[model samples]
Every structure is written in structure tokens, then in C-alpha cells.
Target: MLHQSRQSITCELDAGNSNCLTITACYAANLNTERSDLWVDLINVQQQLSLDSSPWVVGGDFNQISHFSEHSLPSVNCYDSPMSEFRDTLSHLGIFDLRFTRPLHTWSNKCPSSRIAKKLDRILVNQPWVSSFPHSQATFLPPDISDHAPAILNLAVNLPTSGTKPFKFFNYLTKHPLFYQTVLQAWHQSGSIAWDLSHLCVKLKKIKSDIKKLNRENFSDIQERVRVANRLLNDAQVLALTHPTQENFLKEKELHDKWEFLRTIEESYFRQRSRINWLREGDHNTTFFHRLMQVRNSYNSIRSFTLSTGEVVTDPVVMGVIAISHFQQLLAPQTTLTSPCSLAWFQALSPFRCPESNAQAMILLPSDEEIERMLFKLNANKTSGPDSLTSELLKAAWNFLGAEALPWEYRSKDIWIQLKQVSEHTGSLL
Candidate 1:
């Protein structure tokens, strides 16, 4: 935090799980920036701080809008000089509006006939802030005393859940009696489209629906089934022990196996939730497993943090921003002077003279077959993505894939072209 006043309070923080410093700030911009110059002062103050790779956030009633959509009332220009300056400052500082989960407008001018509502308040986070808390989100709460609604920041700190989660093929699904048959029916019923790069994406996307339906029919109420299995097993055991018949013993064996199978399913569910690697998977009764869960919740959880300036912060977004700003300052490249000899050497070195054809060949796009093979080769058992997509599902649905599937999710041709552009742009900027 660099400044603190009635209208604004700045805070800097470095909390657990965040390696960088974050800047959390609240700024109440003067209604007319030209009259008060609050925005100008903000820009000047930020100029004094090193912000490379840092995260900074500013939220409050700026009395300004970056875009026309933010302003409810129609205006001739929509962007005045003050709003334009504010937008430009954000662009230069690499700050963006935090992802929020409520209405954009934070203030309301109680004009019953012609309500003049505008997003006068907002939270902005720098790139580093986003990197630190990818699941962070903002929500607008009801305005009770004031006209402006309060915005709440939610950092996804809760344990992961699979409820309505994106479809991913589990190894256990293959054990079902009609697993392949169900998939076959779903595939045959699914309408065919032109085979294109999106074949896998399309097929996978459609398969999720079928999988969901199958799960609803077969996998729901698993615990209830387990209890029912236990009752049946008890009856079979009684007959086996009292009657002492071979058929009764076989029935008892079958019931026990069924109960164990149900229990195994329950274990798999918890193991996935625990996310601890228990190679010996007969049962999950380890202290380490519980400790892992505690650790995850601990590292991810953020109750409060204190800024370098002594102000305590409880908001997650604020902490995230302050940490980002701190890291940006910390990790920024140290300033150095170029030696004359180095400059001379650079001037003497010849430019690359490779043939245009060779350069083009080097940048050529990978073949579809190569890409498909690579996609399948990626490990199937593990998922390391936000979507939780597993490679097993892709491999299983490979035969049902369409040409557009790959392109739907990842258009290699477009991605490669964009990458080349980014590379060239990066060189120029450097």
C-alpha cells in the first residue's frame, strides 16, 4: 500500500500459497476528474511503483466507465477524457476487471421513470493476480444502506467436487456389463457430421451427454445400493451357515462379492476426492491421506493478511492483487547497462540467411495423423486440466471421432499461426 486517505486506501500483501506481493486498493474517484484530479494522482502514484509481473487491484466508485456498456444512460461520446485516461492507465498497467458473478452495475441513480444505472464501481486485477488465483471470482451483494452494492470476491478454496462436472471416462466405467454396448448404442444413435478437425471435440462433447444419461440410470444412489447389498449378504450367510447346502454357500459367496464390489466403488469415490496417492488401494485408512486434505485446504484457504503498510486485509481479491504487485516488483529484471563490446559483437553478427523454403518447412504444421497419435499417446489415467478431461475418454471414442472434433477444441493451424505472430511480436517488443 502506497497511499491511504478517506476516498482511497492502498494495501500490499504476501499471504500463504502466494509467492508474490499483491496490491489491494480502494479508490473513490472524484465525480469530475478534471476538477479533483484523483485519477491523475492515482496514475502518478502507480508510476512510482515497479509493477512488472505484479498484480494490482483497484475497486470503488470511480464515477467513470471504461466501455459504453458500463454506462446505462445513452451519451454522445460515451467515453469522456477522464474515462479514456482511466482505461489507458489500466491498459498500460496490465490491469483488467476481475471476473465477477453478478450484475455489472454497482451504483444506481434512483430515477424511477428513467433509471440511470452504471457500473461506477469495479475490481481490477493484474495478470499476476490471475495467475495466483485462477478460480477467483467477484460477486455483487445487495446495497442496504448505500446506493452502491457491495462486491464480494470468492477464491475457489473449497475441496474439489465432481457434481455435474465435465464428462471424463473413469476406469471403473469400463467394468460395467453393458459399458461397450451402451457406448456403441450412443455412438450409432448420435447424428453424423462432416468429418473435420473437430471430430474428437464433437464426439467427446456428445459422448458426455450419453455418459451422463448412463450414470443417472446406473450409478445414482450408490450408497443405498450398498446397504441393500449388505442386507442380502446377511440373508445368504444365514442360509449357508444353518442349512449348510452347496447352493447356499455359492449364493453367500456371490452376495459377499457383490457387497465388496459396491464397497470398492465407495472407496474409489473417496480416493479420488482425497487425491492422495495411496498405491495400496485395498482401503484408505491412512493418516497421510487426511493430512493431505488438510494441507490442501490450508494452502488454498486465506482468512486474512497484513499489508506492508500495517493495514490488515481479509478480502481474497485484495490479498491476491497485493501479492501480484509485490512479485511484479520482486521478479522484474534488474536494470543493467549494455557494454560497448557486447554492442559491437551484436552489430558484427550476421543475420540468419536460411532459405525461405527451409524456414517455411521448419514452421510447417504437424499432420493430422501426427496430432491424433500424439493426443492418444498423452497419459490417459491422469487429468491435469481445469476441465478435468481424461485421455482415456478420447482414446475410447477415437473411432467415433469426426474431423471437426480436434479443431473444435484446438485448431492447430490457427494456433500455430497465432504462436508465430506472438513470437515475432515478442521479439519486436524486447
Candidate 2:
């Protein structure tokens, strides 16, 4: 161990280009014990973190759980304040509980009838550490030296090498207050265009370039600012609790608000990366999202594939072309037969539900009330589009953009849509 204290031992090891600081500590051997002092110190270190502090790898027999689910068949009586504090401490410090391969209790009370099991030991890491070593795994070994199972963190695992990744619009980028302004700045730099469609295409291209430059300037490493903010917030909170001075109160509020803002950014980053559409907001699922991304990356990866002519191809460009060609061929348009079948026969095959009453009926455009309902019904946490626009943003900016939704239309499939006629006004710049 590199550093040790009364309750914990810390060992910092260089992993890849960054360093990992592993902290292990034991609260107590018995079921219930007072260890708030130990937790306070850990939080203290987490709060006073420097700009260049190593990625944290904290784990041990914490002897508590933030939520009852970590313990076996828990109920109301199993609640503990210190355990809550422990959970909060990890969360406030931006640490995550690394899940084991198999779900099992780390410590079991050796009795048969009254046997009790709990997951008291866990290995956790910050966002920076997990991002650096995405393939890191944690395993639970059988109890030997003590009653608790040894939690082993294998941090040096390497993921299979793949080619350049595709560009994906991150939902979190939209959370920043300047996100919309940045897009406008990029679009404005594209210069004036005479035609609407051509202007749109050019503006979009310029916007992408501007966004890239903005990202490079603002977010080289995603969690660098977040860690610093968390540390400052921790210090401010501790001071507020201990002293409760007026100046400290204002400082705590500022830090708290800033931390929350950064936290939402972090959450959006994970959500987009996870690609899980049904997930809700305000849940502690950063690690879950990280794992989901890993699984998705593995599942969607094409290491190598053989063509129909038995030619094995491993080049990413070749693989992409082959896959694209295969799909394009399948979807390639065939000449429509002048008369594949009688019109009566095709009409008879079409699905109809009360056609006489519903098919001919037409509903007008939605009103303000209907539009409001539609906006509220959307899942705000779902992924955003390439423009970094999301349902949540649209809802928030409804005052400005709500009326513009009149031009947008939603089409439902019945048999085939037939737009009989359309009209447009033509105009030119002076």
C-alpha cells in the first residue's frame, strides 16, 4: 500500500497513461458499529482532491449498504443512518460500486437456519478511472483469511482493438447552457446561401466542425471539471455543517448548484453512451450505462467476416462496404410490374378497420392543448438527435419553439398515403 491511515490503506498504481488510487478499509467485524469518523476522513480526502489527483479505486468491507437491496431480504428494520452516509459519501465523491460477475453475498453468517448474507465488500472507481480502463473487472473470491469474501479488482484488462468509432450525438452536450449558442456560431460561420436546402446542408456541415472545436476546447477529458467541482463542493458542505457561517452558506449554495449542473451533464453523457431508451433520469446508473456501452460495443463489433466467395476480410472499411452492399442489394428497388395483379385484388388484400367510418375521416392539425399533451407525453430522457436537440430541451424552450411545431407533421401508415396536391410561396432575397 502506498499510504495508510488508522482505518484505511491507499495504494496508487500507474495504469495506462493515468494513475489509479486504491483505498481499502474495514469498518468493523461485528454487525453494528460506529464508524462515521472513518467515513468522514475518506470524504475529506475526496473533497480536498487536487486538479491532478489520481483516479480513485476505493473498496473494502464497508460494513453497510446505502440501500437495503444490497443486503439479503432486507426490510424497514434494517435501515441504518451510517450506511446512508456511506452511500452518500460515495455518490458525492462520484464513485461507483463495481458489480461482480455473479450475484453472491460477500459475507455469510455461518449459521444454517439463521444464516444471513450481505454484500458488504465492494470495489468502486470514479468516472475518469472507469473511462480509462473500461474493461476492468471485479471478482469475489471465497472467504479464507476472514469471514468476508475478497474483492479483487483486475484493472489492467485490455479490450479487443477496433477501428475508428462512428460519430454519435451525445445527449449531455445539449445540457450545457451554451450548447445552442455554439451551434448558431458554427452555422453563422458557414456564410450566406441562396437556396434553402443548400443553406441547410452547408450550415449543418459548419455546425459539426464548430461543435468539434468547441468540444476540444471545453471537454478534452469529460470528467476533469466534474471531479474538481465535487471536491470543492465537499469542502464547502463540510464547512457549512461545522461552522454554518453566512459566507460559507452562500459558497455552499453556489457549489451545490454547480455540482448539480455538472452531474446532469455526466448523467446525459452516460445515458447517450448506454443507448438504453427506457431508462429514467435521477437514478445512479453511470456504471450500468458504462457496462451497457461495453456490451453494445462488443456485440456490434465486426472483427472479421468471410464473403460469399470465401474471402476473409478484417479491414474496417472493407467490412463496412460489404455489410452496406449486402443490405443495399436486399433493399434495391425492382421495376414495378405494369400489372402485377388486378387493382381489385390489391385493394381486397389491404387491411381495413371500419373503413367506411374511419378511412374517409380526416383530423385537422393539433391545437395548442394537443401539442402540450404530446410534449408532456414524450420520454425526456431518450437520446437526442444530431442537432443535439431532445424532447426535454424542446419542452423547456416551448415558449419560443412551440408555435413552429405547426409545420411538422406525423404520418401514420394504413395502406398508402396519397397527397393529391401541394402549394408553396416563392420568394427571393432583394
Candidate 3:
């Protein structure tokens, strides 16, 4: 056991090959004021131990409900102000309830008339836990004598694997000096026959392959690299202290710089994934960002849903089938009409038209300078589109491509598309 208090107790479970798991058993105070301390203590422990990469789980009675739906009888306003502290703490710690089986309410008041039930007990885990135990789940067994149900956490649940994950462009790659070189090399290898939109599409596809190679080579084991770098830096510092030699001091400094560099990269990695813009860089917020990403995944996931036919669907395949069927039915043609309107009826309505100057401006072909400006203005952190093209790639390749003018074949069409996309992206910032 690492630490214990009235509210919580934390411990670490060690496995072979340096794999470790952290677990915390929490039983929070019933009152909001006392519960706040639990939140602070948990956050402090996490920060102190630097357990960002370790699989961690915190389970038991939190004496808190995240949402109003968790309560059998909710407030009229549908807002619980005290819940914010608990939610924010969980966000900061990156803890989320494990998807569970049946009986959502874990605790109930044993009252015959004025009965009350709420999800006061939960098993929450961080992102690393989810990654390590992808099919893990919690089940709330029926309560016997006690009001609270016993929660069972299964770490290893056998399940079919999901298909390929979509490709994403990491903005941190753009900071590396070799990134541009890699893109240029890929572009040369994918030499285009014609400089048109079609050619750009093919070139981008080729670039995506090389970009993946770059990530695998340099950035794939970022967290591991950070750990190794820190270890090396610590060893060098110790050696420098023991030897007190000029060479040893220089070695320590070099390793320290490398460690710092790797840490920055790790921070950027999680920060980008967290999609948190409020917290600026240089705050040592990698842990917070890491947890926030987990929270987002937990929130966005669709573990189970009920169909219109009153059948509960837990299987992803069946859920998808139902979703598609519903959307198809909902969007299907409501009426059968060969001709809904005639030209004469349309001609009776006054045509709303923009000024000639505005119309011309809307269709104006974008210059290379204008396109370059908009591309640079885009958020490089955003994931690449289905085309596997990102703002970072375009900005880096722009210098080489800017010398040539758009091909006359699809110049207007391509330029308009490029301009529209870039404008929309940049406008979003405003």
C-alpha cells in the first residue's frame, strides 16, 4: 500500500517486465464539503507519483453522482452544482466509470414508501487501464443486506477485435527538422505525371505512407523514450556528482537536455490528443491531458443502446445495423411525386441575388499567395481528413510547389475547392 486516508487507500500491483498497475479504493464523505478534500488528495497523489502512463483504477463509494440521470428522482432544474467538483476532479485525474452490466443504481435507501436509489458506487479507470484491458468491464451484483451493490471488475474479458483505426496527423511531427525532408523525399518518389488536383491526391496518399514510417521510426515509443531518457539523465547526474569532472558535468547536461526534449514531445503528444486549448504549454500538464483524453473516449463511446423495438443491443455490429436501418427509414422519401414543382411556379417567386461585385468575389480564383496564407492559418493539430492530408504537410510542401502555377485543365475548380476549405478552417478560429 502506498497511501491511506479516511476517504481513500492507494496501492500498486507490480507485474513482470516493469509493468505496474495502481489502484485506489475510495469511500468519500456524504457531504459535499468533506468530499472536496478527497478530490484534492487524489489529484495530489497522482501528480506526486507521476503515474500518467500506468494503468490505474479507483473504485468504491464516491458518494457522488456525475449526472442527474443517475438519481431515481432528479431536481426540477436538472442541475446539481456539487457534481461539478466531482466531475472536474475526475477530468483532472482522467478517471471514468467502467461500462457496466445491468442495475445502474448501485446504492439505494431501504425505504418502503419514499425509496431513493443512485449510482453512488462506481469503478473508474484511466486511459492506460482502458488500453491495457480493452474488453474489461464492471458488473453490479445485487445487494443482499447492504444498501450498496457489490461491483465486480473483470480486467480481462474476451472480445472480438475492432477493425483498423483511422490515420491521424500528429502536429508534433512538424516540429522535427527531418519531417520536411521525409515529405519531400516521399513527394519525389511519388513523382506526379500532371500537376492537377488528381495528382495532388495521389501524392498525398504516398506521403501518408512515408509519414507513418517517420512516426514509427521516431515517435512511436514516445513514453518509453521519455522514461529511458529520464533514467539516463538521472544516471549521468549521479555520475557527475560522484566524479566532479568537467566531462561528466557536460555529459549530464547533454542527457538532461535530451530528457527535457523528450518530455516536451510527450507533453505535445497528449495535449494534442486531449484537444484542450485552455491549458497552454509549459505547465507540465501531460498527466492532466492524458486523463482528459481518456475521459473524452469514455464519453464518446457507445457501449450499448436500446432499439425502437425495445430490444437492447450490446454488440457493436448489431448496434451499427440498427443505426443504419433507423437512419435509412427516417431519411427515406416521405412522398412519391414525379414533379413537385414547375418552372412557372418557381418563376413567380422573386429571385434573391447578391451584388455583381460580391458574386464575382465569391467565384474569384485564389492566388498561390492567398492559398498559402490560408493553409498556414489552419490548425495543424487537427487530424488529417479522409484524404490523409494535413495543414502541416501542405505548409511544409508549399515552398517547393509554390513555384508552379495551377494547371489550366482544372485550375478554377481546384483553386476554388482549396480556397473554400482553407477559408472555412481559418474562419473557425474567429
Candidate 4:
């Protein structure tokens, strides 16, 4: 134990593998006047010991709720003074509520007639603590006998490894300085084939390989890069301080700039993967994004499925087979149509017949400008097709692709059919 008081006790935790953490178990006073002192005391501990950027946790009954929704009782005033004070204290200490599971309300008044429930007990930590234990969760057990529920913190370090996943195009890659040049170079290097559609597919496939290489070389280990940059910056600062030379100061500045750049890139990378559109960039929301990504992966995972024979199957291989069989059956051709539609049937529908001029226009080959407009209309952030080509990549290399020559026999009708097939399925041409 590091510090002890009537309201709180602080301790240093050593969880093996050189991972040390400082924890504080606190119980604030019921009265606002006395509870104010507890807040000050906790802040004093934090400031005096310089624990701002360290792995630290403070958990216990705060004797108050931070948000209005936390309490069952509604009030005319949405912002309560006591709640505001508690929130401010936490904000000042760089502490935020840890992600939790199980019971939402931790404390109840236990009154059957007019019961009051509030989330007064919470585990809070700083950014450092979250980074150290990214998958940690606090589970609040049911308050059986006592009014306050017991909270258990689990540091889930082990994560299940997944197999090779399909290629996905991230929007942030477009923001890279070398993106446009690298893609254009690869596009030209692929050259053109006899068929226009085949030529486009070949170019796209080539660029996809180049893009993968670019990511592997520069962007794959972003978090590790951030750590290395930070370490280098710290070392340079120390050197400048000890030697006080011009060269040392210049080196420190360069390293500081490099660290900031890498940090920004890392933030953008996770932000795209998180798929959160509301939150804007530059908010230092990387920790939230990282946790959210994990949550999404867990939610989307298929652990088990029930078969048609009233049996539950958890084996992955069996599940894959089941999925394949289901899709194959669904997509199999149907011969049950009593009367298949023919050209005469379409001509009989005079009310829905196309106009003569419109029919002629439709048959005419699509111009480069028309095709470019359609390509630009595609959603850049959407997942890549089976060809591993994204809308963003197509748009970026349009200058080269739009000028490519096509055989004179190719008609607009054939191109339109192919385009429709690409849109509906794998975005690949036959």
C-alpha cells in the first residue's frame, strides 16, 4: 500500500512480466462538502507523484453519478452541481470510465416501493492504462445482499488468431503522399492487353499487389512505428539536454516531427478501420477506435450455427461446408418458369416500350466522359471487389484507363451488361 486514508487507499500492483500498475480503491463521503475533500486528496496524489501518463486505475463507490442518465430519478436540471464536480475532477486527473459489462447500475437503494438505482461504483483509468490493457473489461456482479455490486476487472490479453482475410481498401491510403504516384506507375507498368476489360482487370491486379507491398513496408506495424518514433524523440531530447549542442537540438527537432507524423498516420489508420463516421479526426480517439474495432470483430464472428436437422454445430470446417451448400442451392438455376419471357413478349408490352430515339441512344457506345462520370460516382469507402480493386484506386488511375483502346466491334450494350454484372457480383468481367 502506498497511501491510506479513511476514504481511500492506494497501492502499487506488480502483475509479472515487468508490468507494474498503481491502483487506488476509493470510497467517497455521502455529503458533498466532505466528498469535495476526497476529490482534492485524489488529485493531490496524482499530481504529486506525476502519474498522469502511467498505467493507473481508480475504482470504488464514488457516492455520486457523473451523468444525469446514471441516476434513476429525473430532475428538471439536467446538469447537477455534484455530478459536474465529480466529472470535472476526473477530467482534470485525465481519468475516464473504463469499458464494462454485466449490470449497468452498480448501486441500488433496495426500496421495493420507490427504488433508486445509480451507477455510482465505477472503474476509471487513464489513456496509459487503456493502452496497456486494451481488452480489459469491468464486470459488475449483481448486488444480492449489499446495495453496491462488486466489480471484477479482467485483463483479457489473449486474442484468437484469425486466418488470412480478403483484401480491403482503406480510405486513408488515398491520403498517403506516395499513393497517387505509386499507383500510376504500377498502372502504366502493367501495360494494355487486347481486350479493354481484360486490360483494366490486369492493371488493377498489378496495382493491388504493389499497394500490398507499400502497406507491408510502411504502414503494417503502425503502432510499433509510433513507439519507436516516441523512443527516438525521447532519446534525442535527453542528448540535447545533456550535451547542449546545436546538432543535438536539431536532431531532437527532427525526431519530434517524425514522431508527430507517425502518430497522425496511426490515428488515421485506426479511424478508417473503426468505421466510425461521426467522430472527426485530430481528437486523439485512437484508443476508442482500437477498442471499438475489437468489439466489431467479436460481434461479427460466427462461433456456431444450427443445422436443418435440429443440431447445433460449432466446428468451423462444418460451418464452411454448410454455408457453401446453402449458397450453391440458392444460386442454382430454376427451370420452373411456366413461360419464359422472349423478345416478342417484351414487344407486346407497348405501354412499357422504349422510345425509338432512346433505344438508338442506348445502343451507342458510352463515351470516355460518360464512363468517367460513372466511375467517379462509386463510393470510395466501400469494400473492394473480388478483383481487389477499390473505387478510389479506379478513380486515381482513370487518366491511364480512360485512354486505353478498345476493339471496334465492342458495343455499348455489351459493355453495359458487363458493367451491371460487375456491380452486382465480384466486379469482374468474363
Q: How high is each candidate's TM-score?
A: 0.40, 0.48, 0.63, 0.58
Residue lDDT tens for model 2, 1-430: 5556666766556554545455545454343344666676677666655312456777787777676767776453565776677777776777776644444678888878977888878877766555556567676887986788987777654443457653444545565678777765554566663133333334444555665666666655667777888999999999999999999999999999998777767766766767776767878576677666755553354456667675657676777778788877787655576946887787799665465546455544456676678766876555554344456645544453344333233222320221211101100100
What tens digits encode model 3's per-residue C-alpha lDDT throughout 347-415?
668677679999999977766567667777887667556554566666666666444324455455555
Q: Write down the lDDT that model 2 would get.
A: 0.61
Best by lDDT: 3
Write model 1 residue lDDT over 1-430, tens digit each, in one string: 6676556666777656745554545556456644246655566556766554565666766777787778776663466776677788777766777766456788888779988887878887765566566656666876888888888876653433323544544544555667667776776666566343233234444555777677667666766887899999999998889999999999999999988887766555444545655356666343334434343443454555656675667666677677778777897646688756776577579765689999899987667687787776764335334334455555555665424444443444465554444332222111
| Pairs in clash, predicted candidate 4 | none
Q: Pick by TM-score: which candidate is best?
A: 3
Model 3 TM-score, 2 decimals: 0.63
Question: lDDT of each prediction vs. the true structure?
Answer: 0.62, 0.61, 0.76, 0.75
Better of 3 and 4 by TM-score: 3
- Residue 108, candidate 3: Cα error in Å is 14
Ranking by lDDT: 3, 4, 1, 2
- What's the CA RMSD for each of the models? 20.3, 13.3, 7.1, 8.8
User: Per-residue lDDT of 1-430 in model 4, one digit per residue for the tens?
Assistant: 8888879999999977888999999998999999999999999989876778788999999998898888787762387899899999998998887777566789988898988899989999877786677767676887888999999988762333345776766655766789888877877787754354544555666667778877777777899999999999999999999999999999999999888877777877677666776787778788788866655553355555667675767566777788888887888645575867898878887868668999999767766566667778875545556665566665665565545533443344466665554443336221
Candidate 2 stretches with Cα past 4 Å from truth are: 1-167, 179-220, 234-253, 276-280, 333-342, 348-353, 362-372, 383-393, 396-402, 408-430
Q: Any runs in candidate 3 off by more than 4 Å, and if so which?
A: 1-160, 244-250, 302-356, 401-430
In model 2, the Cα lDDT at residue 338 comes to 90
Rank order by TM-score, top first?
3, 4, 2, 1
How many backbone collisions does model 4 have? Answer: 0
Error of 4 at 300 (Å): 13
